[model samples]
Target: MSIATSVPHPAVETARRFARSSRTHDGLRCPNAAFDAWFARQRLVNRFEVTPVPFSRLRGWRFRSDTGDLVHDSGGFFRIEGLHVTGDLGEWSQPVINQREIGILGILVKEFDGVPHLLMQAKMEPGNINTVQLSPTVQATRSNHTGVHGGRAVPYLEYFTDGSRSRTIVDVPQSEQGSWFLRKRNRNMLVEVVEDVPDHPDFRWLTLGQVNRLLRRDNVVNMDARSVLSCIPCLPDEPAGGAYGRALHEALRPGSWSLRSDAEVLHWISDLKSRRELTQQRIPLSDAAPWRRGPAAITHPTGRYFRVLAAEIAAANREVPGWTQPLLEPAGRGVVAFLTRRINGVLHILLNARSEAGCMDVLELAPTVQYQPCNHPGRPPRFSRAAEDPARLVYDTLQSEEGGRFMYAESHYRIAEVDDACPLDVPEDFTWVTPRQVMDLLRHGYYLNMQARSLFAALLALA
Candidate 1:
């Protein structure tokens, strides 16, 4: 709770006019300047640059054995000016490397059959500055666990179509925004940064979920890699006092941050696990947290369709081929919903949270439902596309035109899993702005669909 107690890194704060309206919390809104700049929305688009060399447009169809899933080009050298570099979402940037050095370098990534791979790596060498490497999209499989920590896991129930087998979900996928997440030719994704960080030049590689680690490492003063590069301070910003200075500052801040040591970090992690168990609430760093930035609900906008999730679908009928059946509903008004249902099949099945161009195939885990705010979204939604345009918590309980049940026309914000200097709480900057404040911000404004009086009068519940 007192982790961020000492602002180890300096923050650049300016007095900006506080908008009276808006419900999304500030901590949930943008990366904290005080916690070091982080771009939550970087992974939605291509992180690095590459020239397309379409081997063949829509090249026929289904792939064969040992072949890659994606057939795109891989030869271009653009600046690593975003998540393309350090994988920090939008603000993650990169230094331009030479064309020759930037060619794709195929590497054997751990993958199984029937999944796709997005292998990309950007490393800096003497002459190979900003050098990028990409690989043919290979099939992938989701990891066994999902969490930012390497400790014990809490168990949960998983029901399949054939019947229900109580399986303990020990391995929580430690997937951060920029963490290496891959989809199989069909099912879930695997995030591999936490498990692979130590190999990163000894803490040189920082995962999105490890923002807290980065701070702790810096404060430790010797356990981690400091972004040190001579003549390049902040990372070359522009025609003014740019990244050169800023980068230096970032790399060097912890030189005096905390008086902690490697022993202290070890002690913290060791004890932290016990503390987590004592509290039944899911810890801030578990797989359930989704603080990293990206589109809220990425569903295909083509039709009013319904589906049985990919992973669960596969489980239902792996003997046949790929994700196949079950109690699937139609997509109403295009309000795409991603459920985590258990699909019974041969071998294992994985359902992920990522969607490719609106088409989603994740397992829908219902029965245990946790509601989250739908924030800063990007997609032509079928039902609630404009839900988060304003800050208010818009909730309208109405009967569906074609239905027999009550539907909640609720406004949403992409709720992110946050863990940092402190435990997840309503940070001071935003706590003052309550539900009323949020209502005011969206009241009759541009992009805002409803006003306070009308919206409040129509709602049946408030979060």
Candidate 2:
């Protein structure tokens, strides 16, 4: 990978703007944000059996149909007991939240007083790259969904089959809320909760290893269970601790989260992941030979190179002070980025000019690295031949990943111990795109906003 896409705050803002104009379902004519708004409108009251649940929680629960043939929300707000909502695709803002294995609404609940109650909601645990549904809520609008609540009401975990072998719990729970009741969808399903374990290291809640033992006959790596156990505060009245506790608390964040869209957050996350992966794929324009031509390339060589580039940039900053001042904040928040490389055990720089000023400074990147090169295109180069000089370099500017086809032969950069600071490398001139586009992909997956696709096109245009 060539570049590490820094946080894409701009892209994220663009995504939020696009999300506002989204619709729920086309035929249904629901705004894409309708469910989030609707769920947001409903608040979770304390100690309530059948009160409204925020849509965030309502989207994931498990339930069974009662005699009244209605849905009941037993665990939080997601599970509906009787009624069945239509297609599993109405909400596309978050794919993991909307795509329930059973259907859009996971199970059905029996209706009472013309309204449905909730059971357990099928929820996907966080930290998973993929969605692992536990319980789901059944929608009762009766659009076109066929659900599993008509027959015997079984634990929501039963719906999951490994496709290889059926997993069984050794011990069983006699009651509905028993640990063994719901089908567990992980390495270890909780068989039973252990008791009397002394609260040694400030043990306020159940431990993950205990949950793993209960669920797995053999030693199991219960990732989610460990996460949950860690989050359960030592006393519910006290603060959470330990590694697991810290991680889980951060993920859950206490209350529900609903926004016009997740475009911004996703954009930033995706940018970080994608660019990090391709770190070694970029050009190291900075460590190249100083410029004689192409006055705007990033490969200017030498201190004079930096001075000239910096001066030009500072001069530009004097014009549009607001837009350009961020360039020289003593930090590398410059609009133009670089792709660095390590060649023959030496580091080199490749500059990328994202905007107009960038286009100017980048040209000086190569030739400016070192002072004397008399316009020679070939020879042993400068730094490498300077025996016993660690601070010196050789800047034989190469246009390709393979420098054999040299662009500038003299004063080209080949710095010693350069790779230590520059772990990954990239070709210098390639247009850089932030990875946060994945969230745009998510929004586009639902087709709620056209800008999602348009934004992708704009990013692609950089290529």
Candidate 3:
């Protein structure tokens, strides 16, 4: 047996290198002082525009004659279909995005002066509040990288597709918004390369710490970038900066004391999956009752949740110059928050085992409160009041959701420190777990919801 055939594997070393990168806040390639001007310049030079249009104006897309589902002519991108769900909550029918293809969201890494740096792109999407945001090196769907849209080749895609060119650090399939996307998932990947790579005006090399700092700002880091960053392994030696950071550091440290054991947490999720009765059946878009299709949009009668609308986009930096497609426009801004409390000197966040209509697993761990304010005008989800209180909030930012598929969808992500007034005895659907427990579950797929993962990425910045 040789060293190449070692049992523990070389991936462990890759993780250690990533850990070192996370500690380096400044990089040799791009200094912290110059990042802001570079990002602003990308936004100014991109020249992105989006115009709302009627469904009839959508090019290469149509509502199916038989099923009334919204689809593309090539049938490669994705489709807007109807899902009928009956679960413990209640019975309801809503519109969901049915994209079966597993797209790739990969980040390329390299050492600059012996410190690991990531390759990030300033990408534009039609639905983004800000037209351009920091994204992964490659964020392409199967239809995209395969050139089904007859567009330019995706830049730096070979690094992800060709295994021999780069070393794989992290690769796993992660779920999107279960409520909106029907059983949808994308491949989250991180790869390292030793060879010299060319740099383009749209791309920049950033340290993990620099990326973490950007996460603190609102709508600066895209959802795909945050999702991929959350997959990086948490090292025990990372610095703990502030008062809250100290608690979080202990929570993420291996073998930290927690209120619930690892087995108990797994058992809780497993028990919910087994006991929760949820029945989902695919139906034609025409059959989705109470949702009416008008000239401008397909919307619910009350117009509370979301609507399907069409948009014409023109981008100077995309694979293609312009295209017309359908987008999901949310009714109003949403609120997703995690309520945390210090128990026995370790911080634990309150998680709800939420079951969405499109979740592959019946349920996944979600933030304490994930709801739209417009849906319940006066009434709010439990714990939201405390989470939103100015005195308790440690982290609060208005972040945008996946902009490629959504139109101007923004959510207020918050992390609040609850005092003794909030009870430790949670409802049956909720549980208390440490940050390390959540990180452990995040290594696998379909365990934590997209909002939780986004919050986790923001949480890492606090440290």
Candidate 4:
């Protein structure tokens, strides 16, 4: 008999490195305390001002006389159009952002002292509440990177776009908020480099543990960064500290026992997709009923869901020093929670097969509860109360949505460990799955919604 040598795949080695980095909170390049001070200094030094302006006052944007769609003169960025969706629930029409172009949300990784550190940027978006937050290494739309905006070149873009410069660790396209953008997707990439990288004033190298720790804070890590970080394939090989940590670690292990097998979960998703019926049609913005356009904004009659408003922004740190664009402002803050429970000694999270007007597919796996308190008034969704219980709450933090498109939009993201009272048999639309299953599903696009992905990243932080 001939003996064969076992060799680990490159991706597996990369994941191991990431796992090691995740265990080290204080990076050699930038310690957590030093990062906090640098972030504060960046906020103070940069000049950022956002002023509300009327539609007529927009510099390069105007409403089409025929379709009444608010579009840019260059027709490169995004346009506010009307989307009519018809399904079993009912039929409705609303203004949705039509951004057909895909963007790049890439993070660069480099090894220092045998541990990996990610390159992060202190980016400022007009809609962020704090005016600045930690963003990805290169968060640029095709238009911005292609010079459609006629601004300065985006820094550190060559590492991701030009493949020869760095080795690809994880490169997958992921969906954004299904309800807000129309068929939107961004290329979420994590690239590792071997050569020395020049330092920029706004950029810093931090460990994966530091990034996860920042996730616990409110509006510190931006939406794009979280989405990309969730794609990193790293699960602790050994049991983590504490009871909850141990359970979470076990749940994330690939071959760990799960309530539902991989085949069963895929079948469930496919069955749901085949049975559900959704039809959407594009119409002019003026034809959207119950929504009126005013001098300053386009608002609904009762101002329930969201409204479209224009803003003039000036940021000294951005590629473009000044610009004018439209922003979607939600009525109120939203709640995105995941209900977790130890099933058969393993942790499992409850996910909902939620459908939205702008989803490319009819349904995507969403959080246990994704709703705006203002929109639902007295009628709260199921499992929300359990998730809000102070005693059962495991992790709770306020996170902002994509600041470039949404104005002051934030959600209270929570993870609660429910008691056995919450039974395993849930509604037809909801199902329980382990973290490993969720991570496996993430390898393919559109399986989990943006809110769920963000919560998954938060869950990993717990381990």
The TM-scores, one per candidate, come to: 0.20, 0.15, 0.96, 0.97
Candidate 1 local lDDT, 156-236, one digit each (tens) = 101111122311111111111111111111111112111121121101222211222222221111100111100001111
lDDT of 4: 0.90
Q: Model 4: how far is 218 from its true place, Å?
A: 0.6
The candidate, 1 or 4, that scores higher on lDDT is: 4
For residues 322-383, write the lDDT of model 4, one tens digit per residue: 99999999999999999999998899999999988888888999999999999999999999
* Pairs in steric clash, model 3: none
Give the top-scoring candidate (TM-score): 4
Superposition-based RMSD of candidate 3 using all C-alpha atoms, in angstroms? 3.3
State the lDDT of candidate 2 residue by residue for 1-463, as single tens digits. Answer: 1111321222333222212211101112222254234222322211112111222232222213222111223222121111111221121110001111221222212222222211222222211112121122221212112232232232333322232222222111110100001111112121211122222110112122222222222111112222112111111211145432332222222221212124443443344333331111111222222322122212224322121111111111011111100000111100111222333322223222111111111111121122223323354332223321334322111111100011111111222223345433333322212223222222112211111121221211111
Q: Report the number of clashing residue pairs per model.
A: 64, 116, 0, 0
Ordered by lDDT, highest first, the candidates read 4, 3, 2, 1
Worst 10 residues of 2 by lDDT: 325-334
Question: TM-score: which is higher, 1 or 2?
Answer: 1
lDDT computed for candidate 2: 0.20
- Our tally of clashes for model 4 stands at 0
Question: Pairing residues by index, what is the TM-score of model 1?
Answer: 0.20
